[model samples]
Target: MNEQISLSAIKNGNINAFEELFRSLYPPLCGYALKILNDSDLAEEIVQEVFYQLWKKKEDLLITSSLNSYLYKAVYNRSLHLVEHKQVENKYANHVLNDNSEIYSIQDAMQAGEIYQIYKKTLSQLPHRCRKIFQMNRDFGLKYNEIAIKLSISVKTVEADMGKALKAFRHSLAEYK
Candidate 1:
């Protein structure tokens, strides 16, 4: 069956057509996602999520392009989102490590007040906007896109601010390591 026919079958709740589409499309979509994500497991998960969403929302979906095009676009977007989320998570982890690393051992670490003082001093060194973005990300656990929307800024701006903040932290906290 052709793409449109299979889609019609899907919209009509035809399980066999859905299965056929899954069998035909899953491999190439997974490969496409893998190229973008560079992790086999994450790529597979993204593709599976695309398929699952497709199945779940089959009724309202409008396939203007070829199903192949739609599926590929979905995979690409999902892969990018996953990469961005991972970047935010890594940045948060680095921030936590830098913020608390003065204590090399249980007995060697500074007192809580001293450590808080160091953290406060390091954070104060950042540019005002950069510090706020870093705080939203690290303290509030917001994703890059969420931070961008909250701040009414672009995602690229959020990323650049995060990079600047991390660089500042690394430069200031080098002594702790």
Candidate 2:
């Protein structure tokens, strides 16, 4: 069937047309996502999510380009977003871990304890509101908007406080780096 005809059928709630399109495109889309994400399960999940969204929004769906190009672009963008999110998570984990060596000795334990002490000292030195904002984000895992709402402040204030807290930590811990 022609691409436009298939899309029209899909828009008109034709299940068979949508199934045919999915069957033809699913494998290639999964493969494309896998190449970007390097995880088979996550790639499949991303492709499935794309298709789900496509179907759910069929009534309002608008494709200015070819369907193939549109699907490929969606998969590509989602894969990249997942990769970026994972990188940020890994970066934060590594920063907290400090040393990733497999061997754990008494001296290493002592060093870690000392580092924790320094970190607490630095945290304490922050202005009261800044310290609370930092704790709300890092300790409580609250988002900036949530923190702002809880404190009756603006999101910008939360962001600025977090920036100040991080800057202080970086300055205080420069020697460790």
Could you give me the TM-score of model 2 versus the true structure?
A: 0.49
What's the TM-score of every candidate structure?
0.49, 0.49
lDDT of 1: 0.73
Report lDDT (CA) for all predictions.
Answer: 0.73, 0.77
lDDT of 2 at 173: 85
Maximum-lDDT candidate: 2
Query: Model 1, range 1-177, lDDT digits (tens) per residue?
Result: 787899899988898999988876676666665655567887788889998899899999998987767777787667666666664233343433444333222223222223444566779888899999999999999999999999999999999999998887777666664
| Model 2 per-residue lDDT tens digits across residues 1-177 | 688999999999999999988876777677666655667888899999999999999999999986767777787667667766664233333422343233222333334434555787899899999999999999999999999999999999999999999899998888774
Measured with C-alpha atoms, the lDDT of residue 113 in candidate 2 is 39
